[model samples]
Target: MKIAVIGTGYVGLVSGTCFSEFGHTVTCVDKDAGKIERLHQGIMPIYEPGLDVMVERNTEAGRLFFTTDLKEAMEGAEAVFIAVGTPSRRGDGHADLQYVFAAVEELADYISDYTVIVTKSTVPVGTGAEIIKRLEGKLDEHLYSVASNPEFLREGAAIEDFMRPDRVVVGIDSDRAKAVMSELYRPLFLNETPVVFTNRETSELIKYAANAFLATKISFINEMADMCEKVGADVQQVSKGIGLDNRIGGKFLHAGPGFGGSCFPKDTRAIVHSADDYEVPMKIIRSVIEVNEERKLAMADKVIKACGGSVEGKRIAVLGLTFKPNTDDMRESPSLDIIPALQKAGAEIHAFDPKGMEEAKHMLEDVSFHDEPYSTMEDADATVIITEWNQFRALDFGRMKDLMKSPVLVDLRNIYGKADMTSNGFDYTGIGR
Candidate 1:
């Protein structure tokens, strides 16, 4: 298979690289000349575990290439994936589809043969039909087909998810499109990975629904954590009790600062907007969005309360900045809300993350960055674990106590036990217990 993936953002880069690793020839195209140049020089625009090594090996094997020339990349390609970002619109919360539509319009001019155009970005339902309508007079009807193949990769574990997906959901209106897509995923077929075939609208809805549902789970557990705090019960035990059931199997049930990053926030908003457009109200999803926003903002109060009802003139140490670890993405991170609120409450912030400090420097204001976790704790009034990066799991309690002005620890992710922190002679507060 010869494939061209447009807009070399996270999904485009990862999909193109992984496709090449599946023994397909892939060329990733981006409009940004600097980004293309960086890719050629073996530099990645974003961080993902194991992605750089995979890109290197595939490029060395002559299976993957990157370029800024879209026409050149599309030449002789059997499939073109439009994996551009679909961020939420400013006011209406609808998916801003200008990028995806523009790519399709530009791509329509360069198709020379029968090609399958797949939407690998998470898009709203009926987007494929809109694309087909856009290309109606611009190109011959028989020359190309548009399909929806939404990505479901997690940020920190994208490569593993791409290679070993739970299932591949593809939506197509024609036999020709289905065949091309099937052949493109033949390797997965050989591995007996289930490839779900459905209509384009259904496929698009699947992505949004899955994300919104997962967001609901986070909100549910967070609400449970709040209830547990009031009732003098441990949310961890509550989560375990419910998660033991096969039907409610544990995933995204961890009580934390709420869901953030690229997918959940934007997708949930887009879906809620889409439902509104159809004159249908998605009340539960709407509540999920409301709860998550409130949760992020409330974390600052959690820290403030732990610091004796005021953070005035206090230096608080924050352990994580990225929404979740293993990626440097700072979009909608809980730290974005918590840190700024803490600063507003007169708390000077010291923060550290293994990979996110560089990006966080741009997003965060007036916060001192540290070289290591222990350095972040130096002379701080209280320490808060915002993201559960691997390194923060096991810490030298004695050293942490020695570094801090006051021995106060707030574990937002519930990474530590109450008994352990109490035994260590520190004032400890966790999410639910």
Candidate 2:
């Protein structure tokens, strides 16, 4: 199948590459000439694990292409996937669908044959109907069909998620659209991957609902972590206790600073805004958003308290900058809030992350970036773990103590045990324990 994926962001780039790996000819289109040039030179715009190698292999095999021209990419394409960003609007919290609509308008002008237009971006409900309405006169019913095919890829594990998705949800009313989509995903179908076929609104809502629910779980556990802290209980034990139950799986049950990334924060806000637009109240999700915001700032307070009720003029070493590990994405990271709050309290920030330093440099201010973990902790008053990278799982406590001016450790992800830190001659403060 020939595919044209619009907007070569994370979703578009990964999806196009994976589709090409599945033996489909995919051309990823973007307006940024520099980004397209970078891809042509084998430079990746975003840092995703193993994405560069896969892109190189697919490009070498002539199955993948990148271009700045949408018309050229859309020519003779069986499916055009609108994988542009639907970021939350600046004040309203509603999903800004300007990019999606613009792509559809331009696509209508170029597509010459029967094309399956798929919304691969995470959008609010009724977006598919809006797409159809946008192309009402520009394209006839026989010329194109709109479908919702929301992506469920995680940041660090996007490649794996795309290649071996748990299930694929597609929204389509037309049998023709379904046939085209099925052919596009024939490999997954053959692998017995569950392909959910539903109407467009349901498909759109599925993405928002899934993200919102996961955000709720994270918020719920975080609130539980607070309660456990007050009641002198262990959150990890509580998480494990409930997670063992088949009803409450252990995926998003880990207590942490908060949930912060591209998807959760933006999608939750967008869904809440959508609910408001329809005059429907979503109190739980609204509370989730509020709690998550509070939690991020609260993490900063945890670090300050660990530093003897003050961080004034203190040098604090932070172990991670990215929202999560294994990717260079700093969008809405807990470090964004925590570090700034610490700085506001007169603490000098020193931070290290395996992949996010470059990106963090632009987003953060007055913070020193380090080449390694120990270097970040050099002569620091306290060491805080914001993101749980693999290397931080088993650090040499003796070396860490020797490097730091004070032996204070705040483990927000609960990666280190209380007994272990206390045994190692350090003042350890962890979430809910």
Per-residue error (Å), model 1, residue 385: 0.5
TM-score of each: 0.99, 0.99
Model 1 over residues 310-378: C-alpha lDDT tens digits? Answer: 999999999999999899999999999999999999999999999999999999989999999999888
Q: How much is 139 displaced in model 2, in angstroms? A: 1.5
Q: Kindly provide the TM-score of model 1 when superposed on the true structure, using C-alpha atoms.
A: 0.99
Per residue, candidate 2 scores C-alpha lDDT tens digits across 1-433 of 9999999999999999999999999999999999999999999999999999999999999999999988899989999999999988998989999999999998898877899999999999999999888888889878989999999999999999999999999999899999999999999999999999999999999999999999999999999999999999999999999999999899999999999889999999999889998999999999999999999999999999999999999999999999999899999999999999999999999999999999999999999999999998889999999999999999999999999999999999999999988999999999988
**Pairs of colliding residues, candidate 1:** none
Cα deviation at 390, candidate 1, in Å, is: 0.4
Model 1 Cα displacement at 141 (Å)?
0.6
Instruction: Give candidate 2's root-mean-square deviation (CA, Å).
Output: 0.8
